[model samples]
Target: MLMKANEPVGSGQTGLSDSEAASLYRLMTWLSPSFPVGAFSYSSGIEWAVEAGDIVDATSLRHWLASMLADGAGLCDGIFLAQTHRAASSGDDVLLAEVAELASAFATSRERHLETTAQGRAFIEIARAAWNSPPLDRLIAVCEVAIVYPVAVGLVSAAHATPLAPTVHAFLHAVVSNWISAGARLVPLGQTDSQRLLVELEPVVSATATRALKASLDDLGSATFRADLASMRHEAQYTRLFRS
Candidate 1:
């Protein structure tokens, strides 16, 4: 249960007590690692950091995760998540396209593109086919390349019937988990170390969740310089395991 820096957990008192809570629990369960968002395959920036020797072990992995949380995923993902929700609710193809383009252009590695975009595209389709959501389906049709991560997240949120904050929180949690998983595999960290990192990151995730509420596109920026460079470099790498 990683908590963003300042995010408050759901009150557990939405008055729906039994059935509603059960449904939400089910939704969260499905959206976890087993959800077909293709999340497990990508290291985001972790793959690149490991390749460049910047992240060689547990300590370095923690350092990289902290920097990424502060610089990129914390803000960029939140902003994109908001955009997806907006486009889906409004049924605006133009806006969705704009978001997709913006996100696609941000990718520096082929793996990054495939990792994020592939999921984004499939996500739109899943929402359309499974939920029969007209707005989301249409949004998918227009998004061919990497769908923006946030936008895909928003669509998933809508499909799950979870509100904005929970949806966003779930996303942040997934990122922390994914990065930890990547670190565990790439840096050969023990399961205990990975879990510890997740626990340590709870406050950061909680804090970021709250700060994310006030963030917009203008505030989206990344300070992980080497990570970004490694992603660019991975596109041409002769061999690699994880996507960017």
Candidate 2:
């Protein structure tokens, strides 16, 4: 198995281990909506898309999200999360901190900035209280800029020794799930349709994660320009169902 010089020696290897149950449980807990990241309150501009008739149904919602997961914030956040996990697992605080800062600075719009940082702060605060570790504590102490959600997820998962690939996969899945939930409400999609959409997106999520594993900061870029405009417009939306 070839490995990058900076990659953790045992990285990308996990499953059915003695700690498998614990690892799965942790990922589920952290990614679940109940984790208090306030994920439900932000749609990443999906609310505006719905308002603009850009996502009036399951098909449109899926189309928009497929692009998001493949090219937009999804790809960028995936790489950030992947790198942060590798750095944290390898005990490279400097690299972890660098990734954290970059992720925070990479937000393109005002709401996008708020969307990530708010969730990041909440994730860190709750994780610190419940899943505290020296590594996490050190990350908090040294991270001058507010951590972004992906970076925070990476740090927490890596510090817990959760495998990188699954962690990124679960985190991205959770992101899509949350967005779907928003669409279901905003697009008024039926519960069954939402579930179906999620099923369809499984392949996209897997492919995005696979790409992210080999990607770096240089790979961070977004092509979801309309969504970006929607996010900016959402800030001034007369009546809104979501924060972003």
Candidate 3:
């Protein structure tokens, strides 16, 4: 069953079990900035937003990221992750392949496509080396095409038996955190402001994950036109610090 927005994940009436704890550990490790998916190298167009003066201060930064989480890539990626997790958990290879194809085709820009697929490939290769499993291997075989970021994460998490709620939550959190990191540098905000932004985004992340868990594939769409435009404009940005 899907977890509620406010429910504790990886815990029961007895609290966290060893297996649950292990799953949490794996999630943390895989989603960590240091996990080597090259997440730090991409700002998801936050750099362009900063350059365009769309995110000039903490308030603007918060609003921009909130929109992204609620209406843009953050929400879309969460839905893909949820769908992929469900398909993998059910051993539905057809559904899994379909999700993979849709996700790969979902990118709004060229750099966006590169950002997701490059990270997805790196994630699968690293996970296979460190956390190999039959399901993970099977996912690689069935998908065949270049996997997108969210699908790769969902597949790996399911292969290791991590629950869907926490996996989706962590994935969104990591994405938001990466964006904040970019803003911190581009906006030249202090560490406190960056941390404060992260704290403020917690509710958005939780709500996004919950919505994604309930979303159907037909619901997949992005309304953040400015954000998409930002991504496209970033490609032509002469002074760029991020890959996307």
Candidate 4:
């Protein structure tokens, strides 16, 4: 998995000189829900789905999550993360700003925008203060306007010189894990069942990451209208547990 520092952007290389253990640890730490991004408070619309009976059981939950990874915000965010990494790696602050702006405006609704921006703001603040890095700082300076969560993460990973494929995979995995956690609480799923569902989605996660790794921003699109509508509806959800 080792790749040279000079490899093409998004080449998915684990740099030859990069410490594999350190890279893994950094990815784990940043992606953990405990990272203070407040990821636990948002459901990414999963709460609305579960309440609407769209995701009632493990099977339904897996199906919904797969859809999200394949054709929804998951795909969009992966592109932002990958593109931002490449731009930040080359110190192209211009491109970084563009990606960040696009990600911010790409949100389909108020809840969706809040979900990305709030978490994004929190991520940059924490990463800058605690896990400071040159690349991360450059990203911040470049995107003076705003920094989306995926873009912030991409900047950090690229600064650390981590491989793109693994970074994106870990990012998406954390996302899915967070959503699963939400599902477990909202649906009151058993711990064993939650783990089982996660296991079942591993293949989907890998495939989504691979697809996003190879995808260009031109490929950005989503067919998950239900999810989008659910998020919009969540804004008015009479009794909701998640923020989005």
Which candidate number would show the highest TM-score if scored against the true structure? 3
Which lDDT value does model 1 have at 158?
55
Instruction: For model 3, give the RMSD to the true fold.
Output: 6.1
- On residues 1-244, what C-alpha lDDT tens digit does candidate 2 reach at each position? 6878897655246545568878998999999989998999999999888888898889999999999999998889999999988887787778877888888888988999999999988998999899887777876666678899998898888778889989989989999999899999997988999999999999999999999999988888999999889999999988998999
User: Which parts of model 4 are misplaced by more than 4 Å?
Assistant: 1-18
TM-score of each: 0.80, 0.91, 0.93, 0.90
Q: How are the candidates ranked when ordered by lDDT, highest leading? A: 3, 2, 4, 1
Segments in model 1 whose C-alpha atoms lie over 4 Å from true places: 1-23, 90-97, 141-146, 159-161
lDDT for each residue of candidate 4 in 194-238, tens digit (9 for 90 to 100): 999889999988988888889988999999999999999999999
Return the clash pairs for model 3, or none: none
**Candidate 3 structure lDDT:** 0.93
Please list the C-alpha lDDT of all candidates, in the order they appear.
0.71, 0.89, 0.93, 0.87
Question: What RMSD does each model have against the real structure?
Answer: 6.9, 7.6, 6.1, 6.5
Which model, 2 or 4, shows the larger TM-score?
2
The candidate maximizing lDDT is 3
